[model samples]
Each structure stands twice: as structure tokens, then as C-alpha cells.
Target: MKKEILNCEKARSICIVQTLAKLGHFPNRKSEKEAWFLSPLRSETQASFKVSLKLNRWYDHGAGIGGNVIDLVCLIKQCSIKEALHLLNDESIPFTTEAPVSYPDNSGIEILSVKKLQHPALLDYLKSRGIDYKIASRYCYEVNYTCKGKKYFAIGLQNRSGGYELRNKFYKNGSSPKDISLFKTNQTSLIICEGLFDLLSLLSYSPTLATIHDFLVLNSVAYIKRTTKLLTDYKAIYLYLDRDNAGRKATQYLLTQNPHCKDMSNLYEGFNDLNDWWLFQKQQSG
Candidate 1:
């Protein structure tokens, strides 16, 4: 008998609504672009989870987190990405019989322009964050986009799903298709961070450490459940989350799942986060 092995990327591309249906989660209501469901992650009387067929993603408004099919599976099954893939692979039944849905006409936001990180205002913002100009240029871009008929711009950090997390002095939000930013170095061990700035701070302060291991930035605490599943292959998962309530809770959750997961937040014991610690060190040297 030929064994059927599942491809992780292929499995992730599967329609989320279809997958949810396979797991007995039919949508409570549907439109051309979105399907609403009572959140499968948590028990609630009202439906709060929305699946965007146009984007092939899901966002639980109550949780304030969103991601792709892999993330959805991880959230639903409480299993690692590899384990979810395994379970999905074993199921031989077709998840959906319908034809591919067309891309929706109204995406709500439009990318007006994308260019190199050369804007003075954005450069100054990076300086304020204590991130080096060279480092910022390598991982970020200057993005201009339109939403609700208004134009805006921000320093954009692209995630694995081609979505950008936008940040500026005045505005802080993510563009559609919210997802985690992953830097894969083919290393067995990995270090996970909570934000892009934190990852940059680590790179600036400890370039050697940054290069030696892979990195994953949660971008938001709500992503912790989905992010945990991606860490299964790492031999040592070092968490450098902020010393805040959300961070502490996420770290505890990961530790519970894998007792060997290391908590490196002690390195900045008295500070708010890695960036805060790095800024303090810079001030002290001057």
C-alpha cells in the first residue's frame, strides 16, 4: 500500500470553511466574501469568528487575531502544525465539493504604492525605536495605501502571508491578512518574539544570537495559540516575550505544552520588553 503523505503548504492552502465543515463547523451565515461562525476556539453565544473567503483567512474578533488554514487547524485541534497536517492527511474524504470561489470585487483596502525604505519621516521613526537604519531597510518598506477613501502610509513589515503589519508614530494597525513574521535560518532551535521591533532589537544587540537560530514574531498575543504549533520542529524554543500579562500568559501556555521551552525574558527582568532594555542600555552608555 502506498502511504499518502500530506504536504504542509498544500494543506494550508485548503479552504478554511471547507476544513471547518469537515470538523462539523458549518457557518452560521455566509456572504460572497465572508462566513460567520460561533468561534470554534472558545465557547460563546454569539458568532464572532469570520472566515474571509476572498483572503482565505479567519479572524476571531473577540480574540483580535487572524491567520490561514494552518493557523485555524492549530487553534481548533490544539495541536502543532505538523500534528494538524498529519490529522488532515489521514482524512481521505473530500473537504469541499464546490468549485473555487472567485476573488471578491471589494477588498476594502488598496495598496497605492510600495517603495524602498527611504522616507525621512519613517527613518526617524526607526531611529526612535533604537533600530539601525541598515537593519530596518533590510526587513521593512515604505508602504502607501488607501482605506475608507483616505490615503495613509507606514513602515511596513511583511509577514509570511504577504500581509504587512503597519506602524508609525500616530497609527498602529495591520493590513488585511494578519499573520506572523517568520525568519527561517534552517536551525533546529528557534527564538520567538512578540513584535517586529523586539526582533530588530535582538538583532541589533546580539547579531550572533540572531543569526544562529531561526526567529518567529507573534505580532500580537492573540496569535500565541496558532504560533505555538509552528514551533514543534525546534529543539529549543526560547521565548522573549514582554514582561506583561499577555506575554506571561502566552509563555505559560507554551511551557505547559512543552515543558522544555525556555523563558529568556529573565534577561530583561526589570524592563517591559527587549526593545525597552535595549533603549535603556543605549541611554546608560551615553
Candidate 2:
């Protein structure tokens, strides 16, 4: 195909909904402003990926990444930015051979119960993100909660202060006493991450990484300063923060404070975070 070379701004403005429809990925449900579909990225039953008709963007809640036509194509086709632009220019190509297949529980969510990881739905959510159930089960719990009296369940990562970082397809919420989680490896070397999924991605990538190094998962990059005291404990600190403005600032601040700290985020340069990188790798590998 003789692809038209389009710039990013122009490529992003392409009608995403129209493009997906042309690709045979019509949404399973629709509204005046938004549409939902089973993610064309992976095979699943229920729809979690959403397309904003007004904003002209797509967000896959399961994978926690979203963007315009160009970004969606990059993920769907597992291609580079330039390749995504080329594919975007060619509308005749329907990438998917098969058909692609949220929740309302608002403010003041309550934790009803916590149990061992066993929910089929939750497991499927993890699978969609390229995380192994066994690895997740080792550190997380199946937390049943309620919001506006509606019952729900999610994968919960507990912190040292007895709080949980709650995540489901529909929402990402944190329980009381939000704090950093530290996994002691009794080793002087440390691997620091920004979120639960990213930490899990490291373990999924190679369990040996954790075996040889301790891990610190900051609930938020705002808590980056909290690690100052702990920084001196490790001889080598490898940072795996998000590749965003705040994460960049945090990484820069940490690198300055702890001379031993190194930005490992460069390893996943194009990705927003480690889990996103891991998901891309897993998808490409398949």
C-alpha cells in the first residue's frame, strides 16, 4: 500500500469511531456521547474499552491506556508510530477478522469483604493485561466492595498500613491510609515502581528480579519524597516510574537526591509505565 505520510496531530484527528467501525469493531453498546465495546485488543466477554464520540479517543480500562486513532492502532496492530500512521491512512484494512465484544457504582465505596483471588471476571481482567493469575494471587486479594449500595469486586494490592489499592475494569480506587508498599528482599539492591501493576509486571517479567532485589511501590508519585529515608538503605536503586510529567519530575528529584538511583523507565521509553510496556511486549510476543 502507498501510505500517505501524515503527521501525528493530523493522524490523531482521524475519526476513531468511524475507523473502528470500518475495521468491523462496532461497539456493543452506545449512548448519546460514548460507546463501549469488547476490547479489540484481546478476546473477552464483556466490554470495557470505551470510545468518546465527543473527544474522539479510546480508553481500554482493562489495560489502563488510551489515546486517539493513532495510539489505538499502534496497540491494535502492535506497530510503531510511523507504521500506525501508515495504517491509519489506509481505511480499507479491517485489522480484526472476528467481532469485538461498565458499571455504575459511585461515591463512598465500602469494602464488604476480602477473599482469596478466585473470581473468574477478575482473573480475566488480569489476563487481559498480560499478568499471570498465580503471580497476582501471591500479593493481591479479591476484594468485594460496594458503592451506592451496588456490590462489586476488584483486585486489591495491600499496603503496609493495611490499606488496599483497588483496581477493576471500571475504576481505580484507593482505600483509607494510602501508603507505600515495601517488599523486603533482604538485599541491598532495590527496584522501585509507581503502581501495583507495574510492580507485578516486574515479577511477571522475571521473578528473579525480586529475588535479588527489594521493591518499593509508591501509591502516588507525590510520595516520592517519602523514599528519601529509605534510599540510603540500598546501594543501587533502580527506578521504574511512569513516563509522565509528574513521574519525570519524581525520577529527576530521586536521581538528584540519591546518586545511586538510576532511571530504569528508559527501558520502556515509549510506554507510560512498566505495565504498559509489559502489556505491549506480551501482545507482540503473541
Candidate 3:
């Protein structure tokens, strides 16, 4: 038998819909569960893109297409199912078998727990991530709570379930588990990155590339096993992994798996990734 997929709650917690909405997609509104936005699928005027907050669903009035959260991300991002969850961290959502209830009791839920975050603290945390306050404020919030005998902070994102995704701002780097986000549009070229931050950081360095080529964030070396298939479909593949041992190993492994995989590591041999390389270049120029 095949391994069972995680629940809706778990899926919702990690999905980046909230972030995407806040960044530029969904407009902020209260009372109504539906949100209006410019259709990401196509450019049009008059805000035909609609997202349902209560149902955690979305629809493009212009395109006459509508779907739940998962459907929207898959279409918007053009990623595989596994890669989609990895990109959005949709696995962060939490759910149980119990029937619908007014309030959920989040005592020992794993992954990201939204019940522990402080509202103001979360806003501050987003600022630290270099995400604009106004943008983040539109989608994220801090959940109120006291856990055990001590107080804990969590970043809350709305979900199909009543719970939120909670990640502490102070966790050790690389301590958290890794996930991959892969996308392959019909474009002729492919651009890869080490992680989500690095991928997003690329937007700052090469804004044009963001729209011109299909992008993939390996999320980690572990995901390379599942990425070879994506390689076969693209005409050109670029490896933008880190300069460290793990990144090198991943890049080499990919080449071995698919002869088409290119070692673009030369572009950032000095730094860990494009972002670091860009930052270093900025310092040198200054």
C-alpha cells in the first residue's frame, strides 16, 4: 500500500498562501471570506481573482476557474505536488479526525503550531526576515496563548482548520527539516537554488530572470533524489546550490543522475549562493 498523505490541517499550516496573498496576490478584507485580486494566471484589469478565506479556496472570475488552496498554489506556482508543498511549507497545517468544532485544542500538535505566537512579536519577526511589514501584515498574525507554565511565540497563518502555522523566530539554523519546491514551466531554461530564501533572494539580483525562466529551489540535497525527473523535461538546467560540501555533493549527484544537469556552480564558487555572491559583490563595489 502507498503511504498516506498528511491531513488538511497539516497541509494548510505550511502553505505559503498567506505570504503570497500578502505580498501582492489577495487583497485584505474582513467579514467576507472571499478576497479579490489581479489574476496571476493572466493580466487583466478590475480584480477578477477571488480567494475564499473561510473555505480556504480561490477562484479566477476572469478565467472561470476556481479551486481550494492546494489547487491554487499548484496552478500559480507550476510545481509538482511534492515540490508545491515544499515550496509553500503547506505541511505546516495541522488536522485531526474529529468533527468540526468551534475551537481547536492545540496541546501537542507537531510541525508548526500557530497557537503560541504573540501578535506584535510575529510582526517584528517578519521584519527580520526582510519581508515588508505592510506586506506581511496583510496575511500573517500572532496567535494569543500561554503554553505549559511558560509563554511561547508562534507565527499564525490562516488554514482550512482553525489552527495556524507556528515557527519560533529563534530556532537554530538548519535545525528544521528540509523540503523542496520545484517548478518547470514551458520555458526553455531552468534555474535552481539551494533553498527558498536563496531562490527569493535571486529575485533581488535578477528581477528579469524571475519571469523569464522556470525556477526550482532544491530545498535541500535530500530532495535531489526526486528532482531528476524534472531535469529530463527542460532543455537547460542550472545548478545554483551552495558552495559547501552538501551543496557540491547535491550538484554532482544531480549531474550523475541526469547528464543534462549543468554545473553552474562556477557562478558562485566563492560564496554559498547567488544571494551571498550578490552581497559580496555589493560590498566589493562599495
Off by over 4 Å in 3: 1-169, 172-178, 282-286
| Higher-scoring candidate on lDDT, 1 or 2 | 2
Alpha-carbon RMSD of each model: 17.0, 12.0, 18.7
Model 2 bad stretches (over 4 Å): 1-107
Model 3 lDDT at residue 70:
53
- How much is the lDDT of residue 155 in candidate 2? 96
Per-residue error for 149 in candidate 2, Å, reads 2.7
- Residues 122-187, candidate 3, lDDT per residue (tens digit)? 656554554444433433455543332234455544432343333335321111123345544578
In terms of TM-score, which candidate is strongest? 1
What is the lDDT of every predicted structure here?
0.78, 0.79, 0.55
Worst 10 residues of 2 by lDDT: 99-108
lDDT of candidate model 2 versus the reference: 0.79
Predicted candidate 2 versus true structure: per-residue lDDT over 37-115, tens digit per residue = 9876554578988999899998775444577888777555545688787777766655665432222222244578999
Candidate 1: which pairs clash? none
User: Candidates sorted by TM-score, descending order?
Assistant: 1, 2, 3
Name the best candidate (by lDDT). Answer: 2
- Candidate 1 C-alpha lDDT tens digits along 1-286: 9776778778877889988888778789999989999876544578889999998899886546678888777645544678778767777644433432222112234567778988888889888888887877877889987644557788988888877777776555566566788889799888889988898898888878756788888888777777757777888889999898878998998889875589999988999999999999888886
TM-score of the candidate numbered 3?
0.44
